[model samples]
Target: MTTLFFDLDGTVSNNFQGISRCLNFALEQLGLRQLTDLEVLPFVGPPFRESLPRAFPGIDTEAALKLYRERYATSGWLENSLYDGMAHAISTLHSQGFAIALCTSKPRVFAERIIEHFDLAPYFKGVHGPELDGKFDRKTELLAHLVEHYKVAPENALMIGDRDKDVEAALHVGAHSLGVLWGFGSRKELLEAGAKHIVDRPDELVHTIASIA
Candidate 1:
């Protein structure tokens, strides 16, 4: 493929600790019951707007979002760490001449900060994500915008992510997808979402991308 779109949360870095902690912080602020990290795992890959409402069932998502970001911006963002071999995989691909960028459901500013925190800023061409105001919240919309803005053919791009939404977004825009088992998603979940290729570890990422692309 000429271009590669990588998902942030689960694929590139293991941000579960940060995400779950922030989620609980928001819940505690709302005087709601806090969830364990494992309980919060399902919400990691999806937008917080969707997850908050579903978790609380009739709470103000906007308020929860504000609280989540309040904590995320300060300490939660720094809680993340790169997946084993992810740096190697990304650098290897960049050296091979594939254009790489981040495609995440996170707000652009937050995603940018996380990239910089991980010292991964130089390897990426751009960060594609929604605004804090919730524009382009859907994966399909974001992917479509990235494709048009970058002048990339859908078929010539491969989206690599750890969740089904990533595969769905790629399919919606007619691009290829590779699902990673190292993240939160299970094998059946990715296959059911129509991901054609799957890799079990970060070390296998480069070869898997080469095969799919």
Candidate 2:
């Protein structure tokens, strides 16, 4: 069976509400200009360490991260909703015997909490993510760590996510990638990132993963 690695934020849950809230809170704390939710949309897929610096030039990345984490750890994490049909899709995948796991840029502690909150823990065999200290912050490094720890061959894994980084990370690790359209990324971005497959809906995930497998 192919090991299916799923991204957490945009792929499974629409975390924009929480992410934007935390982001704006940090910006406000730092006296930076606050951006609208739309302006904050593009930064949802990547890690804050990378996205924050891009979103606000000359901002103290560490300070902003600290502020963001404070709110996120409190109530911001609950400001999320699973994408419609995501729970069903993941459940179906699990029943079909796919070795499913979560591979996300979010910290493991937060990711696990969110997964449990959504009742998704039963479907995932593992929840892989970076630590609070910035280790495995890069997709490539995260995927590599998952591959090593799980002893899954990279070629037999399929990465499914809503961003270019997900596809690029799979490519770097010699795994196939599937991009979902219901998330934050565009078809062009996924294609440009070398995604092997693209599915427009959560309902399409099962068939798409089967095809890739």
Candidate 3:
């Protein structure tokens, strides 16, 4: 079976509004200026540890993350919704005997909760993500751990996501990557990051997967 690794935010779920609200809330708590939706769009897929520091220099990342989590867990996370046709795509892939799993930069606890909340837990074999301590914050590390722990061969594996990090992570492990255009990242970003294939929507995802898998 073809082993598929999917990114959570932007790829499977549209959680931008919730994520932005929580991030802006955290910034507010830190006495920093709140960002508009456009300003927060780039932060969707990357780890907060890196994005927070870069967006707000000299800020206390740990404290800001803590505040963000506090808001996210209560209401922000629930504000998310599955992308149109994503559920159908996941089910189709699973029924076709693909070994599907989630590999996201979001914290493991939060990822699990989001999947469960959306009733998507049945579609995946495993859900892998970083810890709250930020150990697996990088997509490279997260993908490496998923491949190693699950014994997925790099050549047979495919990473599907919406950002450059996903493409970079797959390349780091000698795996192929498929970038989705419906997400936050642009075509230029995915191409520059060396994505093996790019699809425009969830309906196109299955066709792209079949071509490679």
Candidate 4:
């Protein structure tokens, strides 16, 4: 069977509002200036440590992550909704016996909670993510771990996500990469990162995956 690895933020879940709010909350608490919604887009895919320092110079990554988590656990996590048609697409793929798994850079704890909250837990065979301490924060590391633990062959696997990192990670693991346009990353960025396929909508994703599988 073909294995499908999905990214949580931007791809399956539209948690932009919650993520932006929590990030600004962290910055505010740290006595730093807040970022606009557009300005916060780049923070969606990568680990907090990498994104935080770039957004706020001289900030303490650990403290910022702690504050973001504290606020996210309480309210920010709930401030999210599934992207349109994403549920249906996932259900259809699962019904068709695809080995679906979540491969996100977000902390595993948060990824699990978010998936459960959106009732998406049943659709996935596995939910893999980084540790709370930020170990395996890179997409390549996370993807490598998932592929090994599940014994999935790279040629039989596909990675679907919204960021360049996702595309690069798939390339690193010798898997196919599909970039989604409805997410944070731009089409140009996805192309630059060497995405093999690009889909504009959830229905398109279903079609693309069907064609490949």
User: For residues 39-98, what per-residue lDDT tens digits would candidate 2 score against the true structure?
Assistant: 998887788888887767888999998999999999999999999999999999999988
Q: Relative to the unseen true structure, what is the C-alpha lDDT of residue 15 in candidate 2, on a scale of 0 to 100?
A: 85
lDDT (Cα, tens digit) per residue for candidate 3, span 1-213: 379999998899989989999999999999999999899987899998999889889999999999999999899989898999999999999999999999999998999999998898998998989999988999999898888988988999999999999999999999999999988999999999998699999999888899887
lDDT of 1 at 36: 81
Write candidate 1's Cα lDDT for 94-151 as tens digits.
9999999999998899899989888888999998789999998988899999999899
In candidate 2, clashing pairs total 0
Worst 10 residues of 3 by lDDT: 1-10
Per-residue accuracy of model 4 over 1-213 as CA lDDT, tens digit each: 389999989899988989999999999999999999989988999888898888778899999999999999899988888999999999999998899999999888888999998898999988889998778899999898889988999989999999999999999999999999998999999999998799999888788998877
List the pairs of residues colliding in candidate 2: none
Distance from true location, Cα of 65 in model 4, Å = 0.8
Runs in model 2 with CA error above 4 Å? none
TM-score of each: 0.98, 0.97, 0.98, 0.97
